[model samples]
Target chain A: MSAALAVEGLTVGYAGAPVLDGLALAVAPGEVVALLGANGAGKTTLLRALSGLTAPRAGRVLLDGADLSDLSVEDRARRGLAQVPEGRSVVTELTVDENLHLGALWCHPGRAARRVAVARTYDLFEPLARRRSSLGHQLSGGERQMLALGRALLARPRVLLLDEPSLGLAPRVVSQLMGVLRATARETGLTVLLAEQNVTSALSIADRGVVLSLGAVVVDAPAAELADDPALRHAYLGF
Target chain B: MDRLVFLLATGLARGLVVALFALSLVIVWRAARLVNFAQAAVATVAVFAAFAVTGATGSFWAGLAAALLTGAAVNAAVERGLVRRVPQGSPLPGMIVAIGLVMVLQSALGIAFGPRHRPMAAPFDERPFVVGGVPLLSPYDLFVLTVALALVGLLAWLFNGTTLGLQLRASAAAPEVSRLLGVRVPRMVTLGWALSGAVAALAALLLVPTELGLNAHSADLLFVHAFTVAVLGGLDSPTGALIGGVLVGVLVSLVTGYLGAGVAPLAVLALLTLVLLVRPAGIFAAAQVRAA
Candidate 1:
């Protein structure tokens, strides 16, 4: 199958200094690729660049061989690229249902379609469904992550970029989230590029691993090999 | 007893006009998170436009429509061309720019209209309707009250019941997240400004005829009350604007009736300070948990 997402010679930075440079990576359709990196390793920057949140200083991003270098973040989202940023970024003042409603706005779904999508999301994340009327601030961290994921799902994106989905969740919650990710990939053939600091758990479900060090790919290999490599783990991941 | 009832009723009607002005401030705040100091200037310009139109066409309704359109256009222009350029976050620059706009707009109106109180006729009779020898409400007062209520209701419906409104609320709350969700945040901000302008125009149109006349400074007094009302209600909450506006209206009316017109401003300032001290977020601010 053709690569769903491709990046070449990507350079990104803030205030005239490059954070990510000459970054190249590709993911096949239906693949769950864990983007492993330590702090300041350009993981978040890479995802932000791909999702059009951050403009690349130089390089091209291709989704299904279509160049998306010139699109706005919202335009990219409409074109089936969605990102769940760190901190769960829920509109804290809005009700859980309202936040979900915002997700369908990209598609401009009909009332019936919106209702169906929301109901399906509720089914996937029962806790969110239970607190449908609760304001965004009222939800637990796990529920917020679920709500964010569900929101991304409602957009029916082809590729989902998740930035540190396991940041603050409990171990059990992270495992549950990984299971959901696997199930979603299996059912929908959704391509996922997850950036995470939780190395062990991230490698458990990721199909392949792409590790970044100092903004360039250090190791791009199958998940098992990357996890088994003691030297690479010690050098980059520090355990 | 009859005089007291009459004063209270008139005060309530006056308050509705202030409520509309407060609502305008609330709309802009919700959308762009700015106080929009130029709101009175925009309203004054709209009133002058209405006056010019009414003078030429001899149609008050047509003039009112012109005012509404002018308000929307001016507000949209300000948001698109000026306010949006001030950069997001930290409302101080936007406020400073708006204050500058207020000065520019008011001065322009003063130069164009000669800074005199020019009278515009109200569509309905100004004489109060009487019941059992009690003056309850004038036809003009009722008209103002009705128009304000209808406008507020429409705004409530627009905000709570429509997809566009949902997008607006989301856009304001988390613009980046909303952008990620595919919302056109800039467009929503413009829409918010337009809505605020229209409401401000309506409040100005209704109140100017009752004032000394249609002049550049006609909206100044109304704005002070409206600003107080907007603060008394949390800047972000619409429901707060409504209740706070009416409360201010009643307080002002009672103070004017019993303590003389001179004491009304002091009474309002005192009430505002007390509300600020007691609940810094305002009575209807949902951001905080409601006290029992």
Candidate 2:
């Protein structure tokens, strides 16, 4: 089958500093792929390139089967391209309900229907549902992550691009979040391509794994196979 | 008792004017986190337009319309041309440029109109009524009060209800986020400046009849009153600005009516200093912006 999301020959930089240089990767439909790399390995940069927040120097980032190059950020969002940015990207001044409404801003067929969709996301992440009245600023680190995940899902994207979902969380919270991710992918067939630093947990939940070294993919294999390979573990996962 | 009452009554009337001026200040601040220090000068330019047009036609309505239109046009031009040039520059530079523009605007108006006092007809009648066996107030005072209240309500609704208002509020709270969300942030700022200019013009239009007269000096010190209102109300809230305006107006009127007219600015300056030292947010300021 054709790849659900693909990045080929991606080149991106900031202020003349080339962070991601001619990188390539792909994720099949309904698959969960973990992008594992060390800090400064252009992990976050690649995700940003995919989201159109960072303009690539040269590359093609495909969503489903279409090119996402010409679309504006909000336009890209309306077309079901959602990015739960590294730092929990929540609107602090807005109430949680208002933030959720913003997530469904593009789901224009019917807001009542979208509200039901948001409610499902709430059910998936019960902690976020409980704190539905709270402000984004008031949520704890773990709660913020759940809220971020919940928000991205509300956009109802074909494939969800999550950057560093496991950052600054308890071990159990990370596992719980991973479980939610795995379940969402299995049931919803929502393609997911995540860049993360939490090696063990990401590999545990993901079906496949891609390791980056100096902005180039060095290894791509089945998650279970990579976990058992000791040599690959030391280079990328520090295991 | 009579001295106290007269001072208080006079102060109260002028307080309404102060309130209108303050409301204008707050409206601009809310939309763009920058203080259009040039607003006072812009108002002067707008009032000049009002004086000439009304003075020529001897029609208060004509002058008022002319003044407001001119304010909007000037505001639009400045925002699109000058302000847009330095859209994301440091605040201090923007402020300096505003002050410089004030001098330029004043000079431009002076060159065109000359330093002259022109007669402007009052929008309302000169009849006074007896209340408490004293000349309580004239129809003119009533008219000012009505105008102030109406402008406040209209703007309040505009800011809260309209799409323009939503864009302004969203832009004010988070410019980057709004831009990322595909809002044309520059257009929002332009609209905000135009709104502030129009309101300032409205305030000036009311003032030129009696206390302000038709000179360039007309509403020159009016800005001081506006600043007091804004500071008193808490810089963030429009409602606060209105209350501040009325408070300053009444306080100034009372002081001038009883003690002396010259001490009003001093009293306002003192009050603002107190509020800053104590509350620092007006009556409603939020967490201070720091170097991030």
Candidate 3:
């Protein structure tokens, strides 16, 4: 079967210096891939480029064997590519319910369908349900992450890209988040490319681990092998 | 007491128009993050289109419909063709482009239509209704009031009750996140401009019949007062636009009624300055500033 998301010769940069230089990777459908690296490892850039937020210098991104070169960010999203961006992704001015409704906007056209999707999300994220009327800024860090994840999930995307979800969250919160992601992936067969600095938590849920060093993938191995190899973890992930 | 009542009544009618125009500014600001300096010029063009339609068909309703559609179409075109090309990292480039557009549109209008004011007739009677020997709202003023209230109500329902409104709000607040979730952010911005243009056109249409007439600069004073109202109510809040428009309207009416017409502009300036001093964000501004 074709890879769900394929990146070839992907080079991206800022002000002339390439952040991601000639990177190539492929993620199979329904596979949970942990993109592990330290800060400035081009993980964020890769996700952004794949989602069409950042333009690639000399490369192509393919979604299910379809080239996404000319597609706009929103067009990429409409084609089942969803990203939960790092740091305060929720629209802080809007209430939690409003944020979720936005997620279901294009995916679920009918009002009834949208309502059902929103209600289901609220049920899954109990904290969000309790604070339905509350604005995004009012939520705690973990709650904000939950809201962001919940909002992205409402899109019913085929491939979900997440950036630094475990950043600045408590251990239990991270575990809870990872658990929800794992459960959702298992139930729905959702494909995920999760970028993370929290190696242990990411590996716990990811089926495969792709370690990056200075923008190119240094190791593409099973999640179990990467978790067991302490040398690989310390060198690339800095754990 | 009778004079006060008359002034209040007159001010209420005038304020509704100002409120409507200011609400347009608020809509554009929320959607595009820039005040459209050419709004009055754009609306004037639509009113001119209404004039042509009214002249050809001899139907005021046809003219009204023409104005609304033309306003929305022209504003959307401006956003897509001109405003979208400029760098949007800061508000300055967009504001400068809008100001330039105002000059271009006004010059083109003057060249085409000449510098003469055209008399546009109102659909309803202008004679005030008397209640117990007290002069009150006229049929025309009542019409304005009803239309203003209904439009406001409709807009409120659109933004708060519909999925499209949710996308507009989300895109404005967090464009990147909205895009990630499949919301068409640029299209939403264009729609915002269209909505603002239609509202501005309606305000100009209402005011022209009561003013000197429809000229290239007909909506100039209205734009000034509406801008002030938008600022007084906080550019981000629709509720602020409504309240601020009314407040500015009444204040201008009372100042013109008691003092002189010359002093009304000064009073508006003074109110704007005072509001800026007290609350730079406007009275109805949210407590927390939106994250950039």
Candidate 4:
């Protein structure tokens, strides 16, 4: 079963300066939550903090009611916290299959099991299946993003964090990618926390929306309500 | 004709050793993106450890095992203790640290063992076998070739077929993304250092018996050739390292055979200069010119 993720008073920064100061948010099990904000709104920082990439200065990240504040990134990932960072980070030296293999490394760590997991991922994303032997650097931008998403799915995480998955993608490609994501969430009940700039498309698949301005949540409501509120949308999301 | 055969045989044998040393450098560079200037120094210390073990037990195998362990331990310690403290995204600081390590290790070895040559007996008889009226490869040369090939094959398999290898490669290329995928990137980097140290020890052990003897600066000459191979092959490409090692080996052997022993270093320098002028990135780098 997918698990809930709760963040309370999460503060994170670099070089003694706070990027995300005293922020709190909650994601229910099997929920599709969109994190929307302008540039430098600390969406990436919040995702990094949740995935244990950036250390939080003060707060607790409760995963299924367990404190994950002290865990390492790998340890946090082992307990079902997986993240796909911004910029379509494909390991250029590795092949598509190898990238998917890494996603299963912490959990499976065995040849037979990892192979099976990779096969399942290929079934989910057929384009990646065809290009299993292709190096990451050889992949097109859209393919790279698909490879990243497929790799994350192979981990079987309870909650997946995606940072700017739709950036630099064509409109048709973005819609197609989001369509697959929506179906994947519905079928597997996988919880997702997606940080995105494409507000319209992000809300299309999101059950709830949380808007951040200057590292603090200003609008937290149902996706439909947040989308319908013209005043709030204009002020925070820029329409 | 016999002299040609002998030079070719000896050159090929020496080339294997150079390839191993170059491969070691390539492994470390691939994993951490830092050239280890102190590699020879690290191997010299391991040789000293082997020397001590061989003196105590009179068993070359036991000494070899000890040296391998010492080499791996030293490199892992360097990575975790010293190298990790430096910030990432820049190789200058790490390079400086490695250069400093080289000086310190050489001085320490000189103090402990004195600045004199020490004989290191090969495990096998060093007599070349006669073939077609020509003395070609010695049993020791054959052993070196076999071991080098086997180690290279094992490493190739490790990097191509294993999960740890995948993580190591991925971690080296993109640490942040690898971390996101649950790869313990730091651990993998440390493991790469350990593997590199062990391989560097193997290179030193092979080359020392062929040298005048073991000394504080014995591996320095070999390190120069190996460094040339690393640069010639492009630091990032292992295949480049292998081919570069062979090219340097054969080049040195042919030059010494025809031109004279004194002119070999000049030949290496000339070749390096020519390659720099023509293909600065390397023979094996992608066609696009990489930025400095």
Interface RMSD of each: 5.9, 4.1, 1.3, 3.8
Per-residue C-alpha lDDT of model 2 across residues A39-122, encoded as one tens digit per residue: 898887887777777888898988877888887666676666677777736666555665665565556346577678778778
* DockQ for candidate 1: 0.54
Model 2 lDDT tens row, B1-292: 7666655665666777878778777777766677777887888788888777876988878888888988877877877777667755677766777888888988887787778877667867756576777666678878888888888788878866544565576666656444444445677787888888888888877777766356656777788778877887777778787777777878777766656868867887888788879876778665644211
User: What clash pairs does model 1 have?
Assistant: none
lDDT of each: 0.89, 0.77, 0.92, 0.87
Count steric clashes of candidate 1. Answer: 0
Model 1 agreement with the true structure over B171-231: per-residue lDDT tens digits: 8788888988899888999999998999999999998877789888899889999998998
Clashing pairs in 4: none
Query: What's the CA error at residue B64 for candidate 3, in Å?
Result: 0.7
User: Candidate 1: misplaced stretches above 4 Å?
Assistant: A14-17, B288-292
User: CA lDDT of A80 in candidate 1?
Assistant: 90
* Candidate ordering by lDDT (highest first): 3, 1, 4, 2
For model 4, the interface Cα RMSD in angstroms equals: 3.8
DockQ of 4: 0.59
lDDT value, residue A168 of candidate 1: 89
Poorest stretch of ten by lDDT in candidate 3 chain B: B283-292
- TM-score, model 2, chain B versus true chain B: 0.91
